[model samples]
Target: MRTARVQDLLGLLHGWYPPDQAEEWDNVGLQVGEATAAVEKLMIALDPSAAAVAAASAAGARLLVTHHPLLFKPLRRLTPDDPVGGVIWTAVRDGVAIAAAHTNLDVAADGLNRWLAARLDLLEAVPLQPAVGHLVKLAVFVPTAHAESVADALFAGGAGQIGAYDQCSFRVAGTGTFRPGPGTAPFIGEAGRREQVEEVRLETIVPQRRLPRVLEKMLKAHPYEEVAYDLVPLANELPGVGLGRIGRLAEPVALAAFAARVKAALGCSSLRLVGVPERTVAKVAVCGGSGAGLIHEARRRGAEVLVTGDVKYHEARLAEDLGIALLDAGHFATERLAVEELAERFRAGAAERGWRLDVVVFEGDRDPFVVY
Candidate 1:
């Protein structure tokens, strides 16, 4: 197996959830370490805390993938005193790379909220706040002899992906004509002479975020003085990519019973509930980590109950006013599942793709909240 770099491992996650999918206020993607650094072991965790960084270094993890970023706002200085900076310093000193998924992971199709829904056994779960996917159709003209190689380069560079299919492309034989001008080097034909050659019009789908890299690779693989390619923007309007999720239980259960199930499912030692215990809840919505702001959106989506964390007094009152049940699962408890989920996903994805990456879930994850 070939060695993978830190950037390569990061690309696997970003393929599913690009930083562009994150909210404008968020800072996703790399926080620490060099992209060219070779990586063999990866550590997954909910936060890029000091403990997580130390654990990664101790466990000999070359990279740390976390749900939350070590640095959100830009720091004016780097020191071991600042909590965020300390993590950064430790990662740098210990030679461990650090990257975050953040809102990108939160808004991904199979993101944190969807994982939470799956754990609760929610059926037909859909994003409460849905956003469409942005894609580009890449049409490139390549010499017939180089078509396959160029297509392979594009695929390796993060192009030609259309849900469960990869290395996908459409090709048609055609003749391309070009004139080599003075002081120009052409792959074929003499200067100042018009030439026609057999070519293939290759077309494929590429996520808008990966266009630059894909184009670069395609150009490198093409046997032409000047590569001809077109980037046509697409309106895929694909579902499943967004924040929060609304779904139904197999059957309706009393509010109290549902709360108990949620508390047990998420392993929350305590919960804050709004509305009477006898209220029946069949439709439920959830947003992992500080999703009380989505209560109205969930209600609008026909959700009788909203399960999330960090509910404030005002938010609870609004839920009551809206006649929807609310369950306050702590933010840590609600979003913590992503650690193990990401570890397992990376393990499977790496194995399938020959990444030679070893993933481990951080064991030091403990919700700051303690029940008295």
Candidate 2:
């Protein structure tokens, strides 16, 4: 295995959480660095702050992957006085690349919200508001000899997946008739002569987000100069990828007891509860970071309580009116687990690919809000 580059690891990250899955308002993917930059070590953090940048550089890490993006809005100036500018200056000086997963990771199948729900032991959790991904059937006609190769390329480019299974494809053997036109260099048969050749129609299902890449790879692997393919849109919804999760605990626990469990599990310095202390609750909904927005959806999903961070006053009142409990676990505390989770996943990927890369989780960051 050769040295892993920034873009190489990015391929693995995007495979898990495609950038297109991010909310329209969110900016994800590479924020600051060249894609081809060599990376021997990677540091994962919750935020792309100056501290994270400095830590990565000091630790000799060439890449820094963060859950939060370094740049959100357009930059009007590039002075050191500005916070974002300072981070950029430090990163450029140290030659450390920065990339963000952001909302894409939030709404992925095995994402932050799912990890949070698992930590709390939410049994049989489903999305509070399901965000089904668009699916398409890609049918490509290839010569029988090259069908397997083309199918392999499509699978490598993020195609042929249904639920837990991958590399799924269907091939039908048939005879193809075609005639090469002028100035055309055909892989088989002579120009201006009608010919019939044995071919196989390879079909696979691809998420819309991966279609472009899948097509690119398939075209490259095809034997013909002009590949014959059909992309038919499907009405089927890709399941298990969305924001927030609604489920019940193994058994009912008092609202206050559940709150204590959350504090202990998340290691929060402090947390706020917006319901009666002794209220018995079984059904629960959980979302990491600022998920107060899911309160109504949770209620609709039959969750007796919603656990999330950054709950606004009106949202809390709405939860109250809806007869649901609210637990504000603090944004930093809720999202801090992303660093370790991403690091763990990246480590496994690197090892599987036989790359000698060090995956480090940044632990220097602290919650911005402090309690006296």
Candidate 3:
């Protein structure tokens, strides 16, 4: 069995969501264990609970990649004598390495935000806010015969994606000048004589974190001992990273019916609703948890109903004043939908690597709310 390294998993995750995309206050990445630790089996879940940790140990998983963190607030002690302090303590004693992808995963292009938006049937959905400072332009020169191979490698390494279509790159024909010195081996030129050869200038855009990999792929695939490449900083903004989502529905439904639809979609027993039933809901906005803070932004963007969690009394009153409907789906209920998407992602990723990954949805882990 081929064992995966913690750093390998981290590298793949960075492609999905670069660490800089995370909120500054958030703590992400490898929480415990060595980066080079051998990981054959893995357990993926929403939260790193005490029971989940125990389950991971029983399943013989050396690595656990969870969405919610086991330790959000800092811990000053690790002792089994205390009730709650021992949960983390036990995980450490069991030798399981834990990693978390929180807000960074939330704001990624194909990440939690987009996944949730699509689940709600939001057509024409795009990023609520484009990612800043994440796109870079790369220019390289390759021989005419090797241009396609080099370009393909960059695309495979997560470059050349502008909007749609893979392996997308712009090329221009040019003559390249280079000379090999004595004792130097050149793929295209003889030693000691400057030679002009037909070449193509290739250009592509890559995510900032993936620049290194893209460059490496280009170098390795290009048929030259000395590759010529330039990294140009670009002002072109990336449109696929953001916080909340706004989109149009299939058709407008009355606010009450729309709320019920959401409840059925999320399998929630109860939720707090604001605004009159007759209000039509077409334009919609949503953020998974504690999204009441974005109410004004949602209204400003012409959203008739803002579907989110954690609505306070004052927030509800303000929503009513704005004539915008507010659907207070429970925090856990809204966030729980993300788990299935996360599982699918890991399944596909692991399969591609020829590794077996099981995303176990902890049976019986549900919202702790009951109506008496």
TM-score of each: 0.81, 0.87, 0.78
lDDT of 3 by residue, 163-281 (tens): 66666679999999988989988997699999999999999888787888988888889888888888887767566778888899999989899889889988888888899888888
lDDT of each: 0.89, 0.91, 0.80
Tens digits of lDDT, candidate 2, 260-294: 99999999989999999899999999889999988
Q: What order do you get sorting by TM-score, best first?
A: 2, 1, 3
| Predictions: Cα RMSD each | 3.8, 3.1, 4.3
- The ten-residue window of minimal lDDT in model 1 covers 233-242
Q: Regarding lDDT, does 2 or 3 come out ahead?
A: 2
**What would the TM-score be for candidate 3 when compared with the true structure?**
0.78
| Cα RMSD for predicted model 2 | 3.1
**Preferred candidate (lDDT higher): 1 or 3:** 1
User: Residue pairs in steric clash, candidate 2?
Assistant: none
User: Could you tell me the TM-score of candidate 2?
Assistant: 0.87
Residue 70 CA displacement from its true place in model 2, Å: 0.7
